[model samples]
Target: MVTTGDAAPDFTAPLANGDIEAFTLSDRLDDEAPVVLAFFPGAFTSVCTSEMCAFQDRLAAFNDLDATVYGVSRDSPFTLNEFREQNDLEFGLLSDYNKEVTDDYGIAMDFADLGVHGVSKRSVFVVDGDGRIAYSWVSDDPGVEPDYDEIEAAVEDLS
Candidate 1:
């Protein structure tokens, strides 16, 4: 699994923020801004909804620190777009439909009982401007959410 100090794996994925657009992680890094990649299992689920809404609530704090936040999942852009609108999420949602990005980050998991596979394990990574991971959090229990205060502190450190 990617940990703090490791180079964040860069990837280009479809971003859903009302509209689907191409997004390249390196482009954001080039701006010398910290980026928060919050990976959730799926969109619209109870736990995922709460976690994302929590991020939405903390969006202003992250912005104050000049950190860009994005939610990542294997959900399709259409579903993600709806999810964002439904939750009033201001951050863009990345569609890892192929699950490649999830695997690259080493946080992929399976839900045999639900017949789901290759979904992202709830994880959060703060990537500094240099493209190195500044903080990392992973949870096997999808119900758990990252500590917003800790994440804000990590981004503040970058500033």
Candidate 2:
């Protein structure tokens, strides 16, 4: 798993940002803005919904910190499209459909106990302008969400 001070692994994934375009992680980091990558288990679930909407609610603060926020999940770009539209999510969601990105970050989970598999574990990574991880949060229990204020503080410190 990537941790604070480690260089975040770069990958190119298709975005669910309504345009369904490809976004290269390294390319975005070139802008010298901290990127907040929120990895959720699934779309439309209650907890995931609240967590994503919270980000949406705090979008201004993220913008004020000159950070870019993007939700990442194993869900397909198609599902994310509906979720984004339903929640009025302004930020994009990266589709890790193949689970390669999730696995590389060491956040992939086997949810067979819940009749699901190959889902992303709830986690967050703050990659600074230099493409090094500034903060990392991984939840053992998927029900738990990261502390938004702490994430904001991390970004605030980058300034």
Candidate 3:
């Protein structure tokens, strides 16, 4: 997996808003702005919803730090759209449905227990303007959420 001070792997994927577009780590971290990339196991799960809702609730603070937040998962665009609307998420929820980005970041899980395929582990990465990973956190258990405080602190340092 990509580590701190290493260049963040860049990829382009479709967004949940039916926009057939793409975004890269460099594109997001332009102009000295930081990018908060959160990866969840799936959409519509209880823990994922709660984690995203918490980010939505704290949107202002993240903006105050000049950070762009992105929630990524292996969920399809359709599912991502529903998840965004249902949770009132203010940030972009990227559809890594193909697992291209997930695999590039080395976060894809084996799914030994669930018989699922192409699922991303719950993880987060904070990339600085230079496209280097400033901070990262991955949940030991896929069901757990990331440490928002630590993420916020990392963003603050960059700001």
Candidate 4:
């Protein structure tokens, strides 16, 4: 898996806002702005909703740190649109339907035995300016929440 101080891989995907957009780590990390790339197992799931809503509630804090928050999942763009609207999300929710971005970021999980789709494990990566991953957290279980305090501290440190 990619670790701290490593250049974050760049990719393009469809955004929930109905735009086929391309995003790169460097673009987000430019201008000394930090990026919070949060990967969820899937859309419309309990844990995923909680995680995203928590981010929404704390959007001001993240903005104060000059961080761009992006919620990523293997769901399709159409599903992402519904999720964003239903939750009233203000930030970008990216659709990694092909799993290429997830695989490139080394977050994809295999749950064939349980009949689960190959999806990204719940994880968070903080990329600093210059596209270096400054912080990363991967949930041991797909069901657990990430350490938000640690992520906040990481963004604070960048500031």
Q: Per-prediction count of colliding residue pairs?
A: 0, 0, 0, 0
**lDDT by residue (tens digit), candidate 1, 1-159:** 999999999999999999999999999786737999999999999999999999999999898888899999999999999999989999999999999999999999999998999999999999998899999999999888888899999999888
Best by lDDT: 1
Query: Model 3 over residues 1-159: C-alpha lDDT tens digits?
Result: 887888889888877764436665566566636988899988988988898898888789899998988889998888898888888887888999889988998888867787897688889999888888999887758878887888899999986
Of candidates 2 and 1, the better by lDDT? 1
Kindly list the per-residue Cα lDDT of model 2 for residues 68-122, writing each as its tens digit.
9999998899999999999999999999999989988988888787888878899
Better of 2 and 3 by lDDT: 2
In model 2, where is the ten-residue run with the lowest total lDDT? 24-33
Q: Model 4 reaches what TM-score against the true structure?
A: 0.92
Kindly report the root-mean-square deviation of model 2 from the true structure over all alpha carbons. 0.9
lDDT of each: 0.93, 0.93, 0.84, 0.85
Question: Which ranges in model 3 have alpha carbons more than 4 Å from their true place?
Answer: 18-20
Question: Model 3, 29: alpha-carbon shift in Å?
Answer: 2.3
- Candidate 2 ranges with C-alpha deviation above 4 Å: none
Question: RMSD to the native, candidate 4?
Answer: 1.6
Q: What is the TM-score of each candidate against the true structure?
A: 0.98, 0.97, 0.93, 0.92
- With a 3 Å backbone cut-off (N, CA, C), the pairs that clash in candidate 4 are none
Ranking of all predicted structures according to lDDT, beginning with the best and ending with the worst: 1, 2, 4, 3
What's the lDDT for candidate 4? 0.85
The TM-score-based order of candidates, best leading, equals: 1, 2, 3, 4
